[model samples]
Target: MKYEISGKKRFSAFSLYTLSFLSGVVMGLTVAPVGAWFLAWIALAPLWILIIKNEKLKIKNSGEKSSFLIALAWGIGYHGVALSWITGIHPMNWLGVPWWPSLAITLFCWAFVSLWGGIFVAVWATVMARVAQQQPWLRVLIGTAVWCGLESLWSAGPLWWSSLAYTQSPHNLVILHLGQISGPNTVTAAIAAINGLIAEAWINRQYRNKYLAIASGIFITCHLIGLLLYSRPIAQPPAAALKVGIIQGNIPNKIKLLPEGLRRALTGYTNGYLTLVDQGVNAVLTPEGALPFFQRDLMRTSLASAVQQKGVVVWIGAFGERGRSYTNSLFNVTGNGEITSRYDKAKLVPLGEYIPFENILGGIVQRLSPLDEHQVPGLPNQIFDTPFGRAIVGICYESAFPDVFRRQAANGGQFILSSSNDAHYSAAMPLQHHAQDIMRAIETDRWTARATNTGYSAFVNPHGKTLWISGYNTYETHAEIIYRRQTQTLYVRWGDWLTPILLGLSALGWGVNIFWQNDGNTELRS
Candidate 1:
């Protein structure tokens, strides 16, 4: 087990960790809307290589403490940078809180979430090292297993989230179809195996190790198989056509709150709807909170001429309240000056949307809004009816969770819609956020329309392809964006089953290895 790194270590552990973390942050920008995940992949490989070499050296010197410290430090550094977008929350002018506390809360959440990635790396390093020392190929199996196992527990939906591997999907078009069969967990497993196999090669030049070759072959083969499988398009729905108009008014919060902001917001959507009406779209949609205030009665009556002229269905986002609780809501307004129905957003953002433990965090949440609990989490799942189709709506940021869209399709949503306000994060954030919709479309095999206040408003078909998108940093409108019904994917049908199987198989393999080793020793002694 000759394990020392070959060259003089250019940097101390802290410096290496910092470099790795910075790499992760910069690399993560490639995922999703950014579409630069391949760079992250290339950047991340060197970090693992460094870790493997350093750990091997420590093992040779019998430096047990350095091994864990090196591993943990790398884990912290990598995750801290990879998830830095989480800190965007700090600068928001919610309820009017000072920027510092807002940013502090967001940073704390990112720091908390970073622990999961850290734990995965910490345990994987220790286990991979022990196994690679003996059967070098086992590192590939164990690494993939551990990564998939952790991802399975998180699931890919609303309440729980998984993000690391998601960055890669947007960067490489190869995995566009990967989500159909095993979902992102498959990609995560493959990525881990690739990282592990490469690190194993760095540790030892055991060129003849059949197990390593076999493991690497199997890993690549599975991904290739996934690529082939994903080539087929989801079967289109046998349903009637629905006309829809999406308005990207690109409203700014600062301007939106001014004396004329509400009128501007209302006018933009009304004009967009009129354009759609002339274009013969059956339904018109607007981004989340296109209207600053909730005006159930006003929308029902005051806009009668426009509604009458369009003479169709309109779905829009606004503030809705019941008693003291207010909601960021979607409303179905009909042509005859009638309020058809309303669905409130569930799964509110932790600090930005609503405070979880109001008694403890109420003071903080209230500082940003007059109401402590601004929006209520609609009961588990709800779908709204529109002339265009049955739409499962998750307000902005809700699309990040896979399950929110999955269950909607399971329960009969023909298409998924996210009415979002990304104006807060600037144009770059929306472009990045659109990538999540691609995964959701794959997971559910449903078309998704993301209408944003600032930018990245786009349409994703069932196959995870973008049909149309708004220009960055601009107020815009997209019309006649056709929606489709897609055949269900394995992921949609079975939910998170693929991830659990990977975890279970790993446990079984590890247990069998232990038993087999014990038996072999006993036989030799006898």
Candidate 2:
């Protein structure tokens, strides 16, 4: 059955799919870099209307196929646009990958990841289509729950940086504050529920007024609560504040692995550290892989000697040896230049740090990865103990996962230190990555200091404000006063308590819907 676009106009299956895809593209534009955050509130309405209104065709197998395809199209557009930075892997001739092959590999990676993301949305649409006949309230609840549940599940898997919550980060600070209650999923659920209500109002003429009223109430209430949370004072007057320095070495990805690059990195970080020390900063941070050498090799360098002579604490990102394997790790060096603490990266980038199915793929996997050897992942729940206080730490890719930072805060981390190497990608990745840090700061109520190799080195307060940020591809050093507070937000105390509840509710709703439909069908047959 063709879907009606208006009173007389109609949309064919292809038109519906195209429209769904376009709607997703619009939603993608609402996220970071572009940051048209308001668009996110209504961006999914068109797609929802298309899927729910088209349920009349459910008697035919074509209906299921069409719904899945439409949602898949939408997902592809959303993830494709939001994750467009994946294309930066191209021109890998620097890694010895030829031109055409490099372009092919980059495009393939982009399409593969986009397709994976699209699959989650398609599954949600397919299930929701079965319940299109339910009450608007039920539909909205189930839709929001399923969406949040799937996002939580996706977060547990690999490659999940484009959550709906991030659309508000550093832009809609009021909305972002809701993350303190139940993490980013709370914000994601709110967005999904709002869009679901708007779509229901647009499609259900009988209940349009009711749905709109409820939607407005929810929208207003969320902002009000957010305002209260955002304004609530978490700062401690007696808490000690440390002057921290962030170093952005600005080394190009091409030469970063070469001998000359190593020398430059050493000099750059050493000079940045000495300068910051002169400014009276208590601690200094370098980006991930800023020193490509292992800890043993790094400590012998003049940089380590400088730290000892100056008697200032420094957090250095370098490789750590774990038996036969290497780890992407952050080391905490004391005033005496002794490595007192270390936090190894838990979330490793697939095919970048370590190859999956290495034995099966053999030499082919090496060609795809830039690393000389596979790196071992760190154990979970690692925190860095510094002179200032206990600190949450995240290496390059770990910023995308909220639980990593949450665990640290719950375990008594007073502040956050995220180190990254974003020199491989364009400005888009670093900016988005920075936005993720902002959300983490608000959620855990911890001041964050992020140091990156290329750019977007930043310091964010507990309120998701970027106090200081550096430009991309520039050598820069900045210091900010960050507090070490022991206060834990609800999110840190409870840790994503909403996800399991939402999943259970969605499951129960689905089961009840199925049982009710069966009972009605039995009565009709009798």
Candidate 3:
């Protein structure tokens, strides 16, 4: 079937797909390090318009298939641009892999990750096309709900970053504050609804004024509500504040595990710790893999001796033994030189930390990762009970998963400690990683002290403000006073309650659409 407006020329399938891809690229630009955040408000409008057009015109025999292709194009464009930092893994000659094979691995990784993210968008588009005949308001609700639901699903996967909500981080504080209510999904729903409204207005020119007015009202209302949430204080009186030190060793990824590099790291971290202790810091934190040695070997370091002599707590990131396997773990050593608590990283980076199919890949895994053996993941819902308070910890890629922090927060985490090693990638990856931490800070309403091996080490307040950040590839030690708040935000207490409700709404919309179609109710068709 073909349908056309009186004065408008219909777009070819190729043109529509290209437009969708470009629209997604625009949306990706809205995130860091580009930081063109305002573009996000309307960046998705073109893709939504394309989907609506394809659905209305019945461009192909299978509307769902065509819609999926269109949305998949958008997803590829978005992820490809946003996660371009993945290509930084190229030139792995330093890791003993040849130049050409290293390039192939890097490109493969980029395409694989982008395609994984694109699949989620394609699934949402396929289901959304089924309910295209519904009223504009109903369609908007169903679309936003389904989109948020899919995002929640993506979060459950092993690799997830580039959330729609992170687009507003560190730039648009008001919109980001909505995260406190129900995490990033709330912000994502708002963004999707607004784009849906605009698309409806564009497609239905006869009721353009009404649709635009409704969109405007919603835009203003979301911001106003966000302002209300942002203005309120998250911390209560009598909060215990701790002066903590963060160490950025700036160790290059190539030689981090080498003997000479080990000596340099030990001397650098030990001196940084003593310097911070001289400044009267209560505790010090190191980045992930900063020690890069076993727990037993870490105790012999000068840094451990300084901690015991200075009688100050030190949170050190090192390797731990779990029976026969090794684990990327963080240890909390008290002034008495005893390891009081340890949290192993639950989410390991694919290829970087462990091979996915060891039985199949075999020796190929060694060529890719620095580790000879796979690191075992820690159990879920682990939190460190320090002298100050219960601390929520995220190691490297684990910061991308919100629920990891949310669960710990719900279990009574007073503060957040994110330990990362961003030396493998360029500045773009760390900037985006830092944005995720900001969103976590707002959602959990906890002060965050992030330490990185290379750069972007900083302190974030409960409201998602970065109080201090270090330069990239720079060796530095900074101390800041961060309060430990027992107060939990609505998101923490209620969890991701919105995602499940949205998923239910999506299911009902699909079921109702199917029922009406079976009954031959043409009246419900738009």
Candidate 4:
């Protein structure tokens, strides 16, 4: 039966818009720095309630649908405030960008992305509301499947930054364990289900108690699953544990271009790596492009000396040249005095490392960027041969892409190393970036080491626990033990099959239901 409230109460257009926008604001607070993960479970309840109660079309757009405008208001509140960190980059003084122009570019980029994403969110809400008009009980399932599938679809959202699962990151590892069972989308689905239940309880007085019970059950089941994952031992008996060291020169991005700055960086890293070796560490990791020069120049410098010394392996980040094209890559060198293996970052940061759709939007991007971003992206699923065993390396921006690590782990990488230069942005980025890397560790069940310039460098276990970490904006170095694993989790072996399948079925079910509704209407008239 269709779910309807006791009364057909009409909410004002202003009230509905307020409800959606306010809910979105709550949703935005669930991520890092403001890690109030609890809000994620019910953040969308108000918006969902608004959709269920209001059938009248109020908001209008001449060139667009009503749903787009409705979602845009919500998205402006959510993504606008959530992405405000980008506006804090201070590119005016650093990149020679004019003050007002920098603010304008940042605002436009934020608005465009937010509004673009709002279109999809609006569509999802509209469909869910339609489903509720028929089988109200199915709305929760539909919401779960749609949202989970949406998050798994890498191309669905702009910049691949709209992961619903990433919102509960770093703090909500309990709920986060669902990612291991069925990718991050499962976590997203579970959160959506909670909001759906909340909306159900609010609108349908007859089913209020039933809705509340179902919501509690779902919450308990998710957390219990999380408990089971967390309670389990992360590591089995390892064949061997490799002692790895990380060195952060803590060189600020602005000064790295100067010759004197490069000299200081070279001296600092050289001292740090050699010092780690002296401290009996077998391997030392450096930050992304830590040396700030070409491979030939690095080979001719003090860095090569550490590589020449027997039994010590230096996994350093640098630029790889292939006939004028350069790549942000991790180069593996050992006491053998030559490069053994290298992994170029396959997933480059959009605009930061390489411009997206450059052939089409080249001139527009040029005006925004400070550096010559002519970098070529590397091939996917690369695993490097290290002294310990196979290893996966993510250079800088690739930490955001979990598939990079998962594929390598499946290919028998014992551990993951993600080297980044978070110095380009403010202090907040490092923390958020570190949280993203933690998800990769949990996803792959590999001991992960992240070395970064201007900090949040951490040693993460298979369970995504931060075993050891360093402060931001400081020159720091430390060594830790990393384990070698031999088993594959279901997610690593099969990828995100469940999410896509669920979403596809939901869309099919909705289409079929709509066909029946129209057919019945004609039959009744006849």
Candidate 5:
């Protein structure tokens, strides 16, 4: 005969918290760059279980630090494990830095990035304990809303940068389709909703009963909506055939800064353009920072002359330095070798492009990539007039943000030109990178021609289908992208309206729960 312990122990609380965080990590690891997104549902089950157990034990009501500590510990564990892939770059001898130092830095970076999601979870757990009390549905709804609100408010949060939702990527076909309406924020909110549902089920101890039934209904509703949206086929614009060639000059990020390697890098790009010209391509697009050095009048050079002689337009990506500030710029070269139009990259990478607090982190910037004191942010949503058609240019991380592309489309951008270099970051980033391009395509209802330095070059149609894509393991030699244009999508017109409304509804729901004690008591049993 075994003696049974009647009370909830501190160890059990720790175990539950640990399990919640671990589930998040496992869920994150399953999505993108590695497309095992089916785990999103699986990961939420444990969190739901814990929430139910916590309510039954009245741990949320207990005047104890156990719950808080458990949540924090779980957050740390989840972020630490999920973002481990970022640390992969640390071991490599980048810029002659030693492995240990790189590893330490990488780990710290991952830790910082993971903290956003952890903080959201911790706060949600606390809020549900206080406001929702023992009401599971209200608890889940509040938790999801608060998390999504924070994600929107703090765009710089870990949830924004290195997010679990981003990992779901192109494989999360349903969410990717939803991205057309609300962008990635919708997918993120959906993940939070799923997690909250799981937590509520566990708290109520009705995990297999009403919980499954409700979750199935919600899932089916979302899936049906996504299917209907995708089923509405978009019509392509009937424009004259314009042959375009996208050059993916796989320039090594390390040697790009060296003075000696400048010639080689420039030659590589020139040769790629020449090949495209030889193939009788009407337009050629190059990857971002294809030119190591920048000249004020790049189009007047010999490189432009050869392309002009070929009677084709060439779009060159380079770092344009003006007075101490540098801008990621795209130059449009005419057949007569003239700089017809230029569009500077608007959305700059936080740390990679420009550090927020340069006064304090200027030294750190110098140590990392070869960026100067500051890389100036460009004007929001500038469209370049290409020879073949009107094109919106998304440079590097600029593609990830919907506003950038939305504004361009509104300004008469018929197609998209995305130039990125993922070599400086880990190779694994391209999977999500690819997904982002597709989402942008669906949002704008325009075809996208993405040319990356390392890999992930592709042509994505308005239907969120990849007409062309390259492998990620190694550098693709070159890509000559050609695609038809599509009309503007509804999502491009209304950028992220659903997410804000959901956030407002969530707040209202919680307000009702908190202010009206009578309703709260009635729902406590439900």
Candidate 6:
């Protein structure tokens, strides 16, 4: 004799919660560091099943509340489990706050930040639970839409991280080629659609569902196309080449601004630039905030010596003050010792670069801050003209956003130079940041040279392959044959084309659901 529980009755309330959270944890592991990309293909299957397998009796009275709560739990699980490395930073304690209070503040801040992604997951889950009342096939398309839409909006906002597609970056060469077709959203949508089919198949306990077969077929077809694309040669007779020198100074953020630290940074940057110039680089680029002060302070004898060496343009990251506000900027010293072609950072790190609601909440956070933090944003799409070609400058965190590069490339940028200061972050953060650039490179078909003030400085090709990679805690310089790409991708020409279509499909499904609800047809039949 055997006993088996069925549907929602199979698991207790606590057991369901654990299952929901586990789904999210699996999803989180799909991203960088862990990079279990295969898990992303099935991560949401359990969550989808959790929503669909519930009885109408349970959903009717409290489905909205239940769905919202479950999604929030999933968000907490994914973000809380994945980004727990945030606690390692202990940003408040970095400000000299007491250990106890710092711990409290750190947890609170992490939860607050996690809510950004959590809210999107919550919305997606809520809609899926409601849509579960409808056709199973419709659930597949709408569910995919919901996830793609959420990632689309989130990537545009201040708290942007790698998109779900980014999990496969720099590794999954086959699926990663999808970025060349429709940006990262294509891969993310494909994953979501597959999971949706898997969920429906599981709900009816039919492993041989045609929907599952179709989804599988699509996945395999896309991979095959990706393989064909990957096998092709990347260096298709480049129009021009720009040899850039990337300087990585292994300096900690804590001492980087101190007198001795500033001296060391200046010395390290100058030496690196001069060495690369002697080796015949067209230009030399340093990491963000490599020079703590303004342009005048950087006009020292060492800098002059760098300028005097040759016509090699020296691009230094400095603080540019205009009236009361200041910008984290990049500029060049010409052969005539003239400063020109300046690009300021527009996208800022929400808390690190500048505090939000500073006037109202500034008092409370001031005690936790090590120093006054204020940096003004610059105008968008500032492409600097160099002898090699036009270059786009994405300072620090801004490099993570694809549109930042797209806009610059559209404005006629040929090559990409990203300057970052990531010393304050933990071990996993640099790799995460690098993954973003790899996607950007694939999308725009541009060569990317990322110079950071500690680690993860590398040269990436248009095929999203790492040409050269470096380690942390070392002063080093890299010179590579960087190609200038004037070619525009479909993604560059039409930005986020999938997002609105996905959102529209979700809206149509939601509208239909609303009609069914008003007509008292909770059970959607075809």
**Number of the predicted model whose lDDT against the real structure is largest:** 2
Candidate with the larger TM-score of 3 and 6: 3
Among these predictions, the greatest TM-score belongs to: 2
TM-scores for all predictions: 0.85, 0.96, 0.95, 0.91, 0.86, 0.91
Q: Give the alpha carbon lDDT tens digit for every residue of 201-269 in model 2.
A: 988888889999999999999999999988987565645878999999988878988888988998999
Compute the lDDT for candidate 3: 0.86
- Provide the clashing-pair count of each candidate structure: 16, 0, 0, 0, 7, 0
Residue 503 miss distance in model 3 (angstroms): 3.0
lDDT of 1 by residue, 304-393 (tens): 458866578777788888777778888887877566677788767765676678899887557767454456777677777765556778
lDDT of each: 0.66, 0.88, 0.86, 0.76, 0.67, 0.78
* Model 2, TM vs. native: 0.96
Which regions of candidate 5 are displaced past 4 Å? Answer: 1-14, 48-56, 60-82, 91-100, 156-159, 162-164, 206-208, 237-242, 300-302, 363-373, 473-486, 514-526
Write one digit per residue (lDDT tens) for candidate 6, span 13-105. Answer: 567677788888888887667878788788888878777665343643346666676677777777765566566556544356787887787
lDDT, residue 42, candidate 1: 48
For model 4, state the Cα shift of residue 242 in Å: 0.9
lDDT of 5 by residue, 283-316 (tens): 8888787775564756545566677677678888
Rank the models by lDDT, top first.
2, 3, 6, 4, 5, 1
Candidate 1 lDDT at 502 equals 66
The residue pairs that clash in candidate 5, if any, are 32-167, 48-198, 48-199, 48-202, 51-203, 52-202, 52-203
Worst 10 residues of 6 by lDDT: 1-10
